[model samples]
Target: MRRICVFTGGRADYGPLLPVLRAVQKDVALELRLLVTGGHLVGQQGMTTERISLDGFRVDEQVENVLASDTPVGVAKSLALGIAGYAEALNRIDPDLLLVLGDRYEALGVAITAALRLLPIAHISGGELTYGATDDSVRHAITKLAALHFTSTEEFRSRVIQLGEDPERVFNVGAPGLDNIRTMAFLSQHDTSKLVGVTLKTPVITVTYHPATADPQGSGRGLRGLLAALDRFPDVTIIFTGTNIDQHSLSITKDIEEYVRRREASTRLVSSLGQAGYLSLLKISSAVVGNSSSGIYEAPAVGTPTVNIGSRQDGRPRAKSVIDCGEDEAEIAAAIDAALRISRDDLPGLSDTPYGDGYAADRIVHILKTVNLKPLSCKKFFDLPDSYFYMCSNQRN
Candidate 1:
């Protein structure tokens, strides 16, 4: 049996990986192991570690690395702690392959340790660019470190190849989040309204704004602009998910709480809704308004409109379903106004997601089961001579 280890650290990363994790569990040829860490341990967002237990998955390891402090220094120190914890746990479990998703520093830490141990690494969602939060750099770095790549879209697959990875090693499977959409039968409009404690008969908006805490001034400016816009639309009820645990996230969290407390408003702000509840919210929400990639990638699948504000998702591929706006109050308000006007009949037809079709788990499992792990290696760009460029078919030199 091929032993495979998958790591999940935060709610944002976990939302995309849960479906594949389940598939890994059911694969007969695979000994699926789970490594849990980061935000899941913190009680802020329901402590997903407990949720994992409730979901019935046996946890193989829990590495505590997140510091209580929220600063760049804290993030740097946390990376070191994560690498140490993962290296030790990996030595004990010693899976043949290590699987990781997305661009969190914690995921990068584990991937680096796996590479050092000469274990084959299967990385998902690599090569996609997210210009916000330094996640773009971390994602590309993981792409170079991993031996096998499972990209969510064709664009991402081509990017991995351009980065010198062998084309045969990369597979473009649809976004795994879409799998949850395809498989889970969401509640009808009536049930969803009851779940969120709001009436869905009117316009419903879903918002997920994570701060770019890496910046010194703090990243709540965009959230402030969005809040100002939301204030203008008192007719619509909004659902707000908490920000990821980055350097300034705590401050942003406090700001949001204070804003909600000060205003006796019609909106409901939540710390989190699990994968199921969040997806159900997507199904019923008239438009998803936020800086999250979920608005860019997952909303279209259910014909949900998206108003994506700010630079967080600057370089990623998006569908016509999205309206890109800036952090300015007026621009954000205009985008929200446009989004509210988008009727259900006018919602973008479910486009073939650039990310994938919801079947990444099977492809990932197949590669892990069959690939040779002995010669674990990364891609290196060749430096060809200028004189030989004419003779070479490739575009080097």
Candidate 2:
């Protein structure tokens, strides 16, 4: 059996990867090894590694490298520690391939160590753009290191090929998180309200705003502006999910906490809801109000409307369900009021997912099962002709 190492760093990152991970685990010809670290171990982030245990995954290693400091320097130091820890663990396990998802800093550390060891890496969610945060650069860097790419959309697959990766090795696997949505039985509306510690009478706004924290000063002033907007709607109940660990991540979480605490029963602040429960909440939510990627990608799969704030998701594709708003409090309040006015009967049914269907796990497993097991080659750079470069630079498509 070929050993496949799947690394998950946090709750948000794992939600999209879990279906693929389970596929590898049940495959007869594959040995699945899970490495849980980062926010999974952090107490404040719900310690989501427990979810892995509950799901019956065989964890091979856990590295605790997350720090309380939410600054650029702190992020660098945390990455360094992750690299060291992952290097030691990889040396012992010596898997045939290291699988990772997304472009977070923690995943970047795993990519670096795997590249240095000449281990073949299969990266999902590559060839995407998110210029608001440092994640954009980190995603591209991981793409360069990865040998096989499983993109969430055809557009993204083309972007990977444009980045110099061979087209034959790249597969458009759709969004794996959607696979879980198709398979899992979400809690009923009443049960979901119970789990969230709220009565079902008032409208529920599922909040998941995160700071574009890689900015120079990492201020969540936009998020603060969002809270200020929410204060206008006195009857709505805001179920606020916590922020991630980036520069100013703490500030974002703190601001959310203070806003919710001051508002008391009007807002309920919970750190993490595990993936399944959160998706269940998405099903019945009046509107998913935030700049988090969940609003752009996952919510639409379940027919949920999103109120995306500011430039965080500036250029990404959107469904008709999303309502984009500026950073001003009045504009956001107006947008939410408009969303609240949207009749459930008028809401469109879940359409064919542009990001993907629920088949990413099968496609990813097929590639991993059939790929040649030779050590990945990273020395060659894609050679572009001067003519092509000039045309591309001049905006001639």
* lDDT of the structure predicted as candidate 1: 0.80
Query: Which parts of model 1 are misplaced by more than 4 Å?
Result: 189-201, 213-218, 263-265, 377-397
What's the C-alpha lDDT at position 103 in model 2?
A: 84
What C-alpha lDDT do the candidate models reach, one value each?
A: 0.80, 0.83
Per-residue alpha-carbon lDDT of model 2 for 131-155, expressed as tens digits? 6777888999999999889998889
Report how far residue 379 has shifted in candidate 1, in Å.
Answer: 6.5
Residue pairs with backbone atoms closer than 3 Å in model 2 (clashes): none
**TM per model?**
0.92, 0.94
Clashing pairs in 1: 152-355, 174-356, 174-357, 175-356
Deviation in angstroms for 166 in model 2?
1.0
lDDT of 1 at 134: 83
